[model samples]
Target: MTNQIPAENTLSIEEVQAAFAKSYGGLVGQLTLQNLSLEKQVQSLQSRLSDVEEIAFGLKRDNANLIKSQVTLEAEIAALIKAGPTADQIAAQGKAVIDYEDTETIASFAAANYGKEKAAPVEAA
Candidate 1:
């Protein structure tokens, strides 16, 4: 059967309106995808910042502890000298204790800062 339809009857106004609505929906979907991707990136960055803050706080705590220990050590050394352990022996033993404490403090400071997860600067170098 061969039949021809007039252009006016080819598409109704209702059909045109429906087509436009579908196109608008597709556009909204694309925008929503972009919005979600941005949100994910923001969350990732926030997590990284939080990790850094935690490491900084831990380092501060380590420094506080080290200072307290150093003060106690000083007081103990003064008392030992007052007790008369002689000069040379007192000096040698005291120096050994101080050296050990210093090394431990340095190691703790480094660990607290980066948690063995990253490279750090050498203080003496």
Candidate 2:
């Protein structure tokens, strides 16, 4: 007689495998949902990174423009210094440009700025 296991004491291997498959299916579904959530988070982070990069690029451009403006202003100031009397000097001396050919205007300016005793005598041409 061959040794035989009682059918009630042992479960069929197929039934155990089916139970495992059902549990694993649920776990797989949960994992799929978690994966989708993670993907969305990654997309959000990437979008934010792109926005930050754009802002950095704009700031760099603005900084470059400001530097260029500063250099241009410095060069202009240097040229003005080389040219001659600055606004400060002109203001301090109270000097004004007058048309030399306008004798009447020159006479008026001379009379206003200088007393007749110190003013140059006007010559009649």
Candidate 3:
């Protein structure tokens, strides 16, 4: 008796290989798409990182300049304290010399223009 295999029950090797290849190709396509998406995300993050680094560098530079200015100002203040006040500065601190004529003119202008009755205050609600 000859042994016979049923066609419906038997799968061909070529058919199995083709099925496996098709499934593998589909998986590879999905993985490729995922990889592309991840790459884009990485690129975006890198771009953001670059921008933050630039901003941080600028802030550092600005802070350094401010520190230098502060040091210079402190040194100038120290020198000024060491040297004491100038003659003109000491003279300016002395009592003012009033000009009586100017004072009288200013007082007359005030009396003429601002001696009127004051405005009544408004009542708050």
Tens digits of per-residue lDDT for model 3 on 36-78? 9999999999999999999999999999999999999999999
Better of 2 and 3 by TM-score: 3
Q: Model 3, which residues run further than 4 Å from truth?
A: 1-9, 85-125
- Model 2 agreement with the true structure over 1-125: per-residue lDDT tens digits: 98999889887899889999999999999999999999999999999999999999999999999999999999998998876664564443343323355555555455555765544574231
Q: Per-candidate TM vs. native?
A: 0.42, 0.57, 0.58
lDDT of each: 0.74, 0.75, 0.69
**Maximum-lDDT candidate:** 2
> Distance (Å) between predicted and true CA of 54, model 1?
1.7
Better of 1 and 3 by lDDT: 1
Clash number for every model?
0, 0, 0
How many clashes show up in model 3? 0
